[model samples]
Target chain A: MIQVENLTKKFGNVAAVDGVSFNVENREIVGFLGPNGAGKTTTMRVLTSYLAPTSGRAAVAGFDVVRNSLEARKRIGYLPESVPFYPEMRVREYLSFRAKLKAVPRKQRKQRLDEVMERCRVKDVEHKIIGHLSKGYRQRLGLAEAIIHNPPILILDEPTIGLDPAQIRQTRELIKELGQDKTVILSTHILPEVEMLCNRVIIIHQGKIAIMDTLNNLVKDQKIKLEITGNINDITETLKQLPGIKNISFTQQDLWYVVTIELSNNEDIRDIVYQKIVQNQWGIREFKTERTTLEEMFIRITTRE
Target chain B: MRNIWVLTKKELAIYFYSPLAYVIITAFLLLSGYFFYQFVAGIADATALRYVLEFIGFISLIISPMITMRLLAEEKKSGTLELLMTAPITETQVVVSKYISSLLFFIALIMPTVAYVILLIFWGKPDLGAIICGYLGLICLAGVFLSIGLFVSSFTSNQIVAVIITFVILLIGWVIGWAGEFFREQWWKDIFKYIGFFEHFDAFRKGLIDSRDFLYCFSLIIFFLFLTVRIVESRRWK
Candidate 1:
């Protein structure tokens, strides 16, 4: 579990992470969404005990990240954004070193390294020097390093970046499997990755939590659009009077009226709209209800500023 | 404690694995050995090994900083420092582990110089006291340079800058004594000489075990290492 309270970190005069707080429950995969320089990495640094909060507190597994940093760090598996490594080291060698630093018992270090290597799909490059590996393998090796000690919490910063489509899918599947038993706080630019892997989304902008909720609740009420060709003025009036119609916008193209309707409280106005169109003797051309994807919602929330 | 050991092991591996370290080591061994052989070939000066050690001390003055320039700088450069710090270890452990590893590598480079002492024992009646004091002085002097080197490396990602700054700081300590030459006042001269590392090292070359010299080396080590911890901790705050 991870708890952040009023966490603020400053660089010189600028507050990189300003008054941010969030809680992650056990075994929950929380997507940390933010644009570039949005303080996502700064917050992750604070949570991992790499950076001390300038004016607030962060805890992992009930240990204070600053006061009890060593204990706090023991529970966190952090993969920083750069995914840096000692290029001279072999994949297996680096993982084993991390295993030791993470305090994996000496007896189990080899097994842990092997398991993480396999989980990250980097077993083939175990003995190969890390410098010689491709970007995808190096990124996977960073994952392998993070999970080597099998920490309960995983704080991954852009884990799937620079990977091929197939590699991305494999990493996503691996993270999904990891989230089954561990709390994962994944910060990434990929909207689909977050949509597929994260159950809860925390959209951050300018160092503040802009939107935080389940993936479903982010775009809660789905809207419907109906295009009618006959007696569009009457149809507009009828649609405006509908109980759940929160918004109705019309665009005219020649003889047809394109009605875009936004409903509130999960209202399904389609059947009633269809009935109205039939009852009023209005001809319906295109009637459609679409599910808004996370990309659309992401752009809406992040750009709202 | 074990974390320090683990980190030190990895650092030492890097030292041996990298070609630059080997290059530095070979240069160190060749230069120290050549000067040492010359000191022996010159004649039985009785203080031959001490002169060789003093000369090696000067060499270490130049090379020790290079050995530790990348200790923390490379980690910061590559961003692996985040991996190290976010592990279950304190900043103190990180600094100490790196200092110990660089100190060990310096000692390994000095290991061949021990053969010089063995040669002295075989070829001449060397004063064992001066020999032991010379080694003690070299190790302690190394502690001083390595600590400063480690401190400089902590806050910078540029290895060249780390090396240059470390050399500048150590060279200041080395040359601070020369400025005393211009002073007619014994107090000012004594002050400059006292701060310079050469004065304390000279005492050991004469087979003297002065606690003052030990304190100088120790305080310098503690002082730089302390500054390193503060710099490392300030990264989060900065």
Candidate 2:
């Protein structure tokens, strides 16, 4: 439901988003993966008709963001970063104002407000002024505002940043449910959030596309760490001599040794390592394959210029 | 049109909810009332309404910036400008709604002055034509000045700076006609006269409805509103 081609937004001499291209299909929950200042918010702003692209094109729901911005915006429910809100207005009043601004029909306005308030779990504080609400409540109110219009597309920039773990999980579930038949593009600093909700991920770094791939493909390379308790020098030398093991390093604690081996390919060397330990009569303390974390992938991909 | 109304209602709600609006309204009413009473006690004529209106016109140059400084500046500072711009509305639409609401709030501040008109009608024979024309002149002058104020407010997120700069701009525009008297060329004097506000507003305050003054204020309103739209749009790039 959203298409961006070579989008570059420049501020003075610095390009906030440079030659970024990506497409999000209908009913897909795509994660805009990036570190802070990776131009994720800038790109989302262009898509939501909040900023004009300096070059290239972006369209939402088949409407060009610049030429037909009103129509493009009509289809988008945007929750911006930091969630700016009127502190004086009540929760329900703010949501109702948004519903009207988004052109929800007068007849259905109350119903729409009610649905979003409940979906976002902001019903209890519906009568409270926004300044009195906590950060989590304010964040939920921002979510409620975005969904109040029931638009076909939702562009949320870091929706769960300041929430408690339970609130974050609840919001994640809500977003997962919302993406069932609508286009949802959410940006976040949390990596596991993507693993849980996003089918596809677009990782950006320093105003450029770092990698765009499925989460399954992104986390395919996993590493294993082996710990040996007898003759630390002998175990370290033996593991380094094994095949298909590239980065073999030894760390010693008292008489125990932790041998970390990075598998160069998909070979399962646990059997070979175990056999070698038995042949040498070294005590095997622990053996486990470590999960390939997004941090590792992010560093390798973003730093590999 | 409905969108404009919706946005305008939001602006008005913001004004009423804040104590700043109350302070401005009360101060305006009290000062204008005191000025009106002084005009009646000193001049003792129907033209007292016109004098009070002229005083309002001058005072609005000071009061209007306070009314309009936070209109767009606060939105920018708080990042609500993104919300408004990303809504299903044009930048021009945002400008228009803000203009209308500021105008409405200006009317609300000036509405109580109608009691002065009522009192005039009750105690003495007031010239109905001049009262209407004088009030018309005040509204027109407000349209011209408030548009400039709105434009200045859009320039920065600092409300105090917006107020100070707008006050300076209006003050300069009001007094620029004085420099025209020193000019040897008729064209230079005419140009300055055209730029100065008091010349256009003087006839209106004296019960004369000159089309030139009306057109000038109307043109100014349109020009500054257009400039505001351009400045707001340019922010996306810079």
Candidate 3:
């Protein structure tokens, strides 16, 4: 339940978030994928009303971020990239204070606090001073604070950053669980995390939305790889002549030829290439169609910078 | 109002949990007590209540910055300002809470000095009117210093820089009255004397509740608090 229309944030001469527009539907888990300084955090901050956009409008739950910031903030939970906390406060105390700041009713605060602590798996360290906890525990405490009010919208910037593998897995599972009923906009540089957790992905590069689509659609529409061991030069030219073939390159390793073909669109050109190979009487060691991974797509998009 | 109280409570809790608050109060109390004892013994007078009040005013010159140097600076350094600002609380709530908590701690530290007032009651009859006025003056002075310190703290993330800048500003405001005496022009002298902090405080110490003096201190406090809020708001852009 978030809408950003041409949102832009500028720091003097540099545009941190430039003319970016996107919508996150209710109960949808959308991943904001980008490299460092790709304006992901800036965009998230604008949506959360932490930083005022130099131009354009953003709204959460039908409230304009600038005009109705307090009401909008009341309906959304934000976990910044650093997840700053008062180190001296105990985990439960911090979460309770955050609950009060979020304007949870006095009567419901304790129950909401306990529920979020349990959901975030931070109940055990509830009494421990947040400063004394390890990084993973501190991150969980941050998450606990964000969800204490049970806000419908969650804007988490790099939610799984700096966690160990097990902690990452745990957090990923928790995010998936939370996404069941909450609208989550997760910004991170981790491509696989998006593929594993988000239903839709928005890849941002150089402060612009490069690609935004479902994982299945993004992979199905981009480049495809075919490994064929045959007359390398002849088959490469023939594959290039195929209707859907956009670009083809071949690298030889030992006795086999690995050919990577970029397609103009998602189409079945495998049979046509196979017939061409047979007509040319090329030696075929292996022939299989390969779809582009999200990682490959991300690298292609970001590296274009 | 609820948000303000919550933030105020959290700020005070932070002061108590950290060792810095204890260290600041202890150092201030010991130094002021030593100055009070010496000023009493040196003057060869039993009534040192006014002298004690003046000494406290000077002690606030140091203690005020110590209490407020880290107010917004540390929040910015630690990145916690993002958490506070992104919450439902408004910027005014944040500024007012921090200012109120600083004043509360300042009052708490000065509360123990009531023993001195009790001692005066036992040893000699200090003018009750002047004693009340003296305390009023100290509180107002602390308010002014705290506002300036909070403003300075909001300008930088460096606590040391905040402290130094606050101290310099307070020192200048404290001593600027002397500049009028150095000048030969009577109009310039009068203007400097009227603008100085000590001039406004002198009326309060004399058992005179002048509205102009009260308005001056109140305006200074409000002005600095407003600047602190504006500076904090501008940081989000940076």
Candidate 4:
């Protein structure tokens, strides 16, 4: 439902979002993963039509963001990074106002207000002043405000930033439910959040997209770890001769030797390695294949040149 | 149009929700009330609300800034401008809604002073035509001042700065007509006389519904509102 091509947004001489392009299909949950000042917020701002791109173009739901900003914005429900609000307003009042601003039909306004308040778990605080609410409630109130109008596309900047662990889990579950039908592009610093919530992950660094791939494909690379009480040289030499063995490193942990093996491909060579170890008559202590987590991959991608 | 109403309603609610509106309104009423009493008791021919209206107009010079300072400045300061701008509304709608809300609050601020007119009618013969014209003039003058204040508030995130700058600008607009007397040249005189707010307002005080006065105030209102819209739109580009 969203398409961007070579989009570059520069603030004065500094480029906040530089030459990035991605498309999100309907009913897809795309997580924007990046560290601070990595252009995640900036990209979302451009998509929401809050900031005009310095160069290139972006369109939302078939409307150009700059030229048809009103139409494009109409389809997007954005929760800005800081979750700003008029503190004097009651939670219910604020949501009602936002619903009106988003052009929610008069007939459904009350129902929608209640629905979002319940879904975001801010129903108890609906009558309370926003300024008096705690950070977690305020964050949920922001989420309620975003979805009050039932927009098809949601661009949330760190939606679960301030919530507690249980609240975070609840919000993750809520987002997962919403992503079943809506196109969601949420930026967050939590790696597990992305792994659990996103179908595809886009890692942006230095205002450019570092890597974009499905969650499964990105974490498909595996590593083998083994602990064997045997001659380190002989074990290394035997492992090197096996096909699909990219590289191997060994570290001594007291009497146990910890060997980490990098596989050349997404291949299971455990049986071959087992036979080789048996042939060598090495005492096997531990053996397992570890699928690389998004955290490790994210650090490797972002920190690498 | 519905969006404008929605925003205006929210803006007005914000005014009532904060202490700023009550404080300014109460202060204005107390000050205006004291002056109204002084004008009525001190002058024998207190048959007209002319002086009182003028006093209210002058009081608005100070009160308009307070009314408008937070209209846009607070939104920018609190980051709610992002929510408003990202909504399906144009900058013009946002500016117009803010202007309308402040104007409504300004009207509410002056609504209590109508008792002075009633007092005059009960005690003496008062020209209702002139009185009506005076109120019309006040509304138009308020339109001009509040628009200027909204325009000033648009660019700044600091409420105090917005109020001070708006007051300064309105003061200049108010005093420029007096400067016209110092200009001996007819061209310079007309320019100052045309731009100054005092001249336009004086005509309404004298019960003359001259189109020139209405045009000048309305044009100023439209000009400032247009400028505010441009500033709001420029935010995206910035």
State which candidate has the highest TM-score.
Answer: 4
Interface RMSD for every prediction, one decimal? 0.8, 0.9, 1.1, 0.7
Spell out the clash pairs found in candidate 1: none
| Model 1 lDDT per residue over A1-305, tens place | 88999988889889888899889999999999988999999999999988888998988999998888888888998889999999999888888888888889989877777788888989998999999999999999988888888889999999999999999999999999999999999999999898899999998888888888999787567778777787766777888898887788889998888888888867666788888888888877898887777788778877884
**Which candidate number maximizes DockQ?**
4
Q: Measured against the native two-chain assembly using Cα atoms, what DockQ does each of the candidate structures obtain, in the order listed?
A: 0.82, 0.67, 0.66, 0.91
Could you give candidate 3's per-residue lDDT for residues A92-190 as a string of tens digits?
899989988988899998898888888888899999999899899888888888888889999999999889999999999999999999999998878
Runs in model 3 lying further than 4 Å from the true structure: A221-289, B42-47
How big is the positional error of residue B184 in model 1, measured in Å on the Cα after superposition?
A: 3.3
Tell me the whole-model lDDT of each prediction, alpha carbons only: 0.89, 0.89, 0.88, 0.92
What TM-score does chain B get in every candidate? 0.98, 0.97, 0.96, 0.97
lDDT of 4 by residue, B1-238 (tens): 9889999999999999989888998899899899988888887474447888888899999999999999999999999999988999999999999999999999998999888888888888788999899999999999999999999999999999999999999999999988978878999989998999998898898789999999999888999999999998898888
Flag clash pairs in model 3.
none
> What fnat does each of the candidate structures reach?
0.91, 0.68, 0.81, 0.95
- Give the poorly placed runs of model 2, Cα more than 4 Å off: A224-287, A303-305, B184-188
Candidate 1, residue B190: how far the Cα is off, in Å: 2.9
Candidate 2 docks at the CAPRI level of medium
